[model samples]
Target: MGPSTIPAAVDAAAERFGDTEAVVDGEVRLTYRDLRTRVRQVAAAFAAAGLKTGDRVAICAPNTWHWVVAALGASYAGGILVPLNTRFTAAEMQDVISRSDAAALVVATDFLGRNRLAELEELGGVPEFVLTIEDWAFTDEVDAAPVRADDISDILFTSGTTGRSKGAMSAHRQALAVAAAWADCGAVVTGDRYLVINPFFHSFGYKAGILVCLLTGATLVPQAVFDVARTIELVEQERITILPGPPTIYQTLLAQPGCDTLRLAVTGAAPVPVTLAERMQKRFGTVLTAYGLTEAVVATMCRPDDDAETVSHTSGRATADFEVKIADTGEILLRGPNVMIGYLDDAAATAEAIDADGWLHTGDVGVLDERGYLTITDRLKDMYVSGGFNVYPAEVEQALARLDGVTESAVIGIPDDRMGEVGKAFVVSTRLLSTEDVIEHCRVLLANFKVPRQVEFRAALPRNASGKVLKVVLRKESP
Candidate 1:
């Protein structure tokens, strides 16, 4: 209902928790006062670097307080923060930066440089200034001016499974609305320690972890990468109350030798297997299954106070201030203030995604029950045709997840001269699962056409920051 920019919100939190630890990353610990000061310094540096209001600054980093500092500083200086996927190639990075007309970039020193950053330096259309997290130096004189809620705070790119990524411009008001919906209704309390395993380059990580911590005055435990043993230890050591991650993350953490310290485990991005959810609740605590998209930041979250049955089955109820509807085609469309201001610089996509009535067409197909809980069955774009029979990848992947050795699976439609388009599976398993075993498992549940024509086993499947299986990466890696 009101403006909630990063600077204003952090200023409030600093006043309340100045001496308290606001962030912990390995050996580094920053208090609320220290974070506030650094954010202002970065804002001042951006201003000194000749950045103006509404300019875009891309961030390619992991889950560090530096990423938060850069993002919050950009918001404070009235610049649009564009988060670049750390997995992307140099060409991909150049395309996004050039397309967004980014004035500068704050990149990770060694994490994302190996792929294509060196090539980006040689190529034209580079950002005016490139600063790394370790080498960034900022002054004390930053003129913190008031910013309008209508100003675009960040541009998160989500171009779907295919094609180039589109920058989803999110405003200060929308970001705050998402945070408020979660805090007011989803039970994220102040002083709650949120273990952020997801990368800050993603909308899920930015809104769910960083913004939520800032809004609730929660301490942020920023882990650079997801390691089951380390994550569990952090939860026990820090007494982390809120653990937000993906299905794969939950599966791995639950399998860890010792991980019973978490008070609440919140999962999203992919559907959670009912069996895994049950096991988590029976062993650990309640593991709520939530569903959301980059378009809306986070549309639905399974409340922390929900019963085991509710948390295990549905994506829980819509948060306060949002409406979820099941379209005639079983598509999930959302209407809310948390929805983004359409795709950046793409009017046609903006028109297609957000309708005239302000509903966001979330490209996910699912249903809403009598109790108003939503269940995402499949992704509309991930559905493919095989021998005139329609096949949903989620269906096949779900079946694969049930197998004993299968840790993760990704299904895609590869070219098949015989069947036109045949289903192919790339799987990651704890132990090597034979192709015959995977095929037989799928054959038992799905129709012949829906079953994967070929099953390939890998030590680990490619995944994005949100833990969503990277079908594109899988397709590329497949022989």
Candidate 2:
């Protein structure tokens, strides 16, 4: 048979890996058999509650077994699952719920308590049906449902690194393609246990972390939050074979007291600074970088067998099923089954993002090296013209991040009458540093035009739930 949909994977695992542990929390453990049963029951319940095909169902919660079960249930019931970031403000939360026209919301009682639900209900546009994780489980009756490959599976909203948020609509076939690509690239096999630190709310988290577990019969160990010490404990205890996280996560875990038992570690979300990969390899023996987004799922990932230089320097070779190229203007364009259909309810963005040739304009500046490795230079939106020269913020930010006493940095174009626009920097640091410090650092590695004209200190740069720096917010408040 061809590849199965997300629900079909649950069915196959239910029989093949029945008694094996599929999900594990600190004190809670569930076998595949039980997990599948819960998913079916939840699907039945959601169906009985008037959820229909193509309806949008939103889930706002942290990493937990319930998140996986609810998401799969929605997929099985032929509804579009919308995973909302838990860190969103009340306004942000309402905005997404309204924009997506979600018909129902499945939230965790602990995460989106009664007060938040009341607040969300008060918002004029939300769908009437709302159920907490606890309530959904306790329901007395539910009905059965099924899904097809082309059915819409999820709507993942991403606030462009510089623009307003847009929901990327992913179908079941596309979601399944991600799992297939990940397995082929990483050589993932049945029985491999993946530690899931990234939240399931993200497309990367759902497709790479949870769906991989379902398709490959791998076990999933879920964590509520990223605690370096706790992750080490789980890794050693669970003997987690595959780990996908950002460089910051790996860095923190490498610093943890007992981080020796991991077999494979994949880092992404932000650039994996060269030095960070070296430290991880020296400490844990397995370190690789992954590059992906909410729109295209996982387009590229470094293999575990790759050398430190490859892991540190490149985002990794493009996925086997995907095509990557540098547009004339340096933007990264992708063509593959992994690319989402389009942004939901936003025709303008859909037209702007995809062209007649079917390539999804990723809008991230990148270079395809002679070896076929892809190195992301910066966000196309984040690239600014300084004195008529194109300046990439990632290059300047990386240089500044490497400076002594600099914790994090962001570069943006600020108005300048003489030069038209010039680079300005916002820094988060503890030690005293000046604009000269950042300017000198960039001078050593970058052109004079790319260096920051001014540097300002802040306690910490504004970041979204996924820990991505919000340059959009930064530019708004710049002096």
Candidate 3:
């Protein structure tokens, strides 16, 4: 049997693929052995700074070798990793740090011309042991911690329906299993160079992108930001084979000058047209579609041999040994080892999410054909995907509530050509308000993706019989 724990998996990768290239960042390339050595060095530094077993360590940085090293080092030190979105404001970052009760924080100071550490400190969210990614002085190596399969590995936060972010907890074994399952479905193997365009803060990036590279011995090329020109340049320069992201990524890449080096393309955060899938098949030899959330890292995937119709029309059959079913209300249900243990420190919410019989309610409506293939139809929640990031309407509405003169607001997602969808907010304000005024206020409190692009003035929001805002009505009339 292979290593189950992530730390052991890292060591095993070094032993098996010692001389193979492991990571390719700008001017810094490391073999599996060198990567393991650096990971242990950072792990020793974390230990010297007083990180105890099972303590929470939060990382707020962009996608780079620094992020991979820090995240793995925290795991080596037996810390439950809490990844924070780099796009979030200082106050928003504080909310997650306080909610997760992280004992330590590692932030990047040079990203986007902002000193994040000082900002967080100014906001009073700096934790016990704080370190900057640009400067790590410790060089001593320490032994990797003895982590069990059932031990909690990470607590990734996802926005909830009630304007709060909920942390979903997953064990070390589940994380590894889900990654391996995704690798198998996507046909990722040794010697393949994967350009990870997905942000490291999300599961699709951390669990699927990072762990898949660790397990399969594929070289990881981290893209800090998604740029069409730079991504193609990396594809040619690094000889990238596997690239996985949302549909928007492929649509942009397909329009660029041809680069036939791409071998596999995995996509799904938004709807993928059949024409796009066929075009992908011609460009990349293999294309696969997957369905997952923060709760389940990878629940379903299309196989390499599957046709374009199967790959495009449905999210494909369930992977990761998951049992897929549909509830009476049409919500997709999943029961498997990869399913998250529960939400962090919220038993009531956990029970509500996963039923007494153990099936997890996905809050996504889908249908299962006779072949057990799952096709996502619509979302039961009012959440929408913008540039592959989930934008919860309630969360945006809450931000609008703080704006002066805004009495009531309803947020909906409108389809866009570039981005799969963008937010459209309808405001009922006391005084006259301009679209720029409402958007400028949200820019300070929320992430760039969460800020509404379009705003409309309304005398009063449409309400239902229960006095709840009729978001469906607002969506239908979305601009």
Candidate 4:
């Protein structure tokens, strides 16, 4: 038999590490025994409130102990967990809730100065019973329903970069597989302190963050927001061993003063600069770069023993249980137990994403070297032909990031009278920089066709909740 379901895994971990710390927030600390008891109580509360098997429960809140309890409670009650992005506007949240047909919602009354309950009330499609964390009651009479491995575990909504967001349905098996893969790849161990800065709505946070900790018996320290000074303080105070986020998080940490003592660092969701990887390795004990989509929680990750160059340039090999192949057209395809069941309520879209052979055709282009390291070139949709020369925006963006004083950069293809299409760059810099300066910098590294024809300066690039640059928004904003 394979590993147990998420709830079962938590139960086992709680039994093994009874009095050990399991979770830590600002003023709250929960031991494994306490966490298990609270999770069971929350499950009983959901059951007492009339939640049933296969029902969907939506949770829209920041990273907190409540978020963890509610999610596990829903799963324990045999309900499919639907984690809504706390950053989503009212309309976006409504669309997802309505589409998923969520029977109940558990939201934080106020977080980051926004009353999520009020936003839901304004939208007015909320289910009959809404519960806040403070009001969650514990009951000992209710028993959790038995869960099967094939049962749906979570429906994680995509970032909606291309169009309407699709909820990727993940089964209990897939969730557990992802957690095991992350633990093995990232070297998560019992008694390790993990600082979860990624939002709960993202797979990187929920599955790789929460579930990995549960499986490995690591203490989870949830951070609601990414404040450099606060994060540094937490790292020093808590002795955080596992910290993971996008490249920007590491870059900012590297720039911050007195920010060290991180044992394992994992970065993904964007291309990692070699310089950033080198710095992280020098500061932290190990640095691993991962790659995955919403459909698959973590498909590949660089091992801790990997050299800096391999960690920086490649996303490492596929996880031990997964099969990764580069299609003839350079599109990356993955087949494994971690692949999501399908997109919720969208069979046509699911068919389009996963083939009949069980291969998930990732729209990103990549190359697998002889050593099995996969280097993501760019998203297939982001590639444009400029005067018959193919140009990938990620390549241009990487070259732009190499320039001095450039903190962040994004590249997109725009219409051109002569070349049919040309690359345009949007940059965020610390020092004063001009369009000519950017063009001149690219001139040294990129080819004539690959060089951006126009440059736009912005204080920051618009990014989704997961830290991916929203090129769709950038393309619309660019003239």
Candidate 5:
């Protein structure tokens, strides 16, 4: 059986994989034993700083050795971790800190060549006990706090559909369960090396990336910033065996060199072109697709035996012991051990999300095939009707992704005199293009209603920190 709580997991890793290298952060190689020792020291530091049980500890930093230690250390000290998005402005950071009521703030001194702490202070977000993530250590003698499996471990905020972020609190057992589920799906094993490209603030990085490594005894290699050249160097130098990210990550890497050494690759946000899936299968021995959200870190995942076409078209069947069902309305509902406790302190919203039947009503709409594989259609909110027929923007966007020179695109519904509502696409391209270039291309791939009625090309699309397109922002823009 796996460890019950996260601290217990760390301790188990020390005993089980003691001499094995746990982390590789550029000249700082730590064995599992050393990792546990550092975690205990940082936990003691948190206690010395007057952190109380159940108190919230907010961390604002990039993915690094410091972020891993600080987050794990906070949990070891009986504190709830609140990881803030590095892309957030000072005001957004202050808002989350106040909302979570974080008692202590651990932040990076500098990132992106800016003084992060200074910006927060300038915006009047001074916490009671502030410390830099780089220097979070103490030698004071203190017994490590005991954490029950039921205890709250972290409050990860997710901004879904509404554009406003909500804190989704998860217990120790739930977090570990989700990570273990993901690890099993990806075939993660001891002695494998994983390069975490996802941000630490998101559940994909924190749970699936970090905790998965801790559970399977894989070495964790963190990259502070994602530069294609730098990432290639890390893969070669560390001999990375596993890589996972969004489809865009693989798309960009396909054009770059030195990624042929990867043994496994995982990606989501589907409608993955069979072409790209085939390319990834050539470079990586195994490519898997998964579907997850903040509430349930991992629900369904394609297996190693799954083919490239299966990985491209579907997110695979449920693997985390999650019960996947389609409501009569076509919305996806999940019930499993990995579901979060609830949205932090929002009883009404929680009630609306999880029914008395114990199923969490996922706002996403999807389809389940005969073999139990799942294919996400689109968000219930994002779906629009054109000429008395329903249209999913993801389908149109998938068609757009296939067009040459069309790098990224987001589609929203616009008011149409004849159809009442029609699709409008905001595209990011590699070369010059006109509206006819996009419309004519879509006419061949999609039906008349599913085609975008108008097109706008921009240098970039507005995205949230988690890398989701801000369709709400696009809806607010003047056509």
Candidate 6:
């Protein structure tokens, strides 16, 4: 029988995989049975605190067993979960909580030496009753609330590069569908020790990272922060089988000495170079590439059986239960059960995102090859016309990635007196490189219009919590 809700899915998994280890965070470990019991206790506590069905519960914390339990428990108690990015400032978190109208907040008292709870309290406008992760205790048995597949399960806020963050509402079916699709595509299986380095606030980590593990009976090893040394130690000590993150994650792991070989490596959130994919595949037994947005998690993924070239260059075929089509304008459109319900309280934005025909107008540009693999070129907003030639920054960035000594690169369009707009490249390099050198390197690979007119070197590129380069920030910083 198909699972009706997220709670139901976890409950069924617990019954089937009773004694199997489900979650591991530092010294804490819990079996599937133990996880279910804790979830029920938390659910009971939430209900007793006067939270009702459909109430929103905001959780602002790092990746921890408490975050997992709070997410599951919020759903079990019939409340919708809103995971706030821990990297957000006090004002940003408060804005999300206020916008979400969260009835209660579960936040970490301290993380990375910053007292988030104290900040939230000082910021005011926070929900009255704030609960810390450590305060959670097992409570009396409570029945899981009855919920339909189409009921809203969570409202994930977008990264908000341009304006205020919009909450993407997702249904129970959508969440479960994406988790199952990721598991099927990534070959996630029982006993696989999945190291979740991606933050739980992001859909990739919460749905594909946490939910997938629960569905497939995989053991979850939660890494709150992405420290190279700690990650290497965990991979070796725990014998982690699955490691998924952005391209930079694999690059860092490869650079770290004594890093254990990975059984499976999944990379996304940014462009993956062919060289990086080939290297990861040679190092790790299997390397997979995937593409998805907050609206629909795991839309496309490269299969384990796919050749290195396919895994490296393309985002693979559309996932099962989803349909992908490139619009005439080259924008990637998706239609599937996994598409989010809508944007919370934003009718105009919701209408603009999903059309009457039921396709989510993904603001990304991509192409489908003869083999049906998809190559993401750039975001629609990031595309610029230079001297009547359309230049996709991602294409230029990919060429920059091939340059020796260049660790990472981000490209943006800046005003040009002659051309309408010209490309500007921000590079993080291992060695000092002159602008002339970068321009010369790009001229060899990219067209004249696509080549960066100016190059600036930085120690590191600005990135969000998910490791996606903040191109908007680069654009603002450009002269």
Best by TM-score: 3
Top candidate by lDDT: 3
lDDT of 3 at 20: 94
TM-score of 4: 0.80
Candidate 1 residue 437 Cα shift, in angstroms, is: 25
TM-score of each: 0.78, 0.78, 0.98, 0.80, 0.80, 0.80
The residue-by-residue lDDT of candidate 4 on 1-479, one tens digit each, is 43567778767778888888899998899998888888888888788778889999999988999999889888888889999877666666888899999988999887777787897789799887687865766767344578888999999986333436689999988898888888888788887999998888778888988888888889999998778678878988998888987666677778776656578998765556787788889988799987887888788889989988998899989993889999999999999887989999889889989999999998889999998889988667776656434466766777788899999998888877445578899999999999999999887655466789899999988989999989899988878
Q: Give the Cα lDDT of each candidate.
A: 0.76, 0.77, 0.90, 0.83, 0.84, 0.84
- Tens-place lDDT per residue, model 6, 1-479, is 55869989879989988999999988889999999999999888888889889999999988999999999999999999999877666766888999999998999987877787888789787776578986766668688998889899999987433435689999998898889888988788888999998789888889999889889999999999877678888998888999987676678788866556478998765556788888887778788888887888778888888887898789999894889999999999999878888899989888988999999998889999988789988667676656434466777777788888998988888876445578899999998899999999887655466789888899988999999998889888877
In candidate 2 the C-alpha lDDT for residue 165 amounts to 68
Candidate that beats the other on lDDT, 2 or 5, i.e. the better one: 5
Worst 10 residues of 5 by lDDT: 157-166
Give the per-residue lDDT of model 1 (tens digit) for 189-254.
667788988778876678877887777778899888667678778987887777876566667776
Candidate 5 at residue 439, lDDT?
94
> Which residue pairs in candidate 3 collide?
none
In candidate 3, what residue range of length 10 has the lowest lDDT sum?
Answer: 252-261
lDDT of 3: 0.90
Off by over 4 Å in 4: 137-141, 159-162, 255-260, 382-479
Question: For model 4, what is the alpha-carbon lDDT of residue 64?
Answer: 90
Candidate 5 — which pairs collide? none
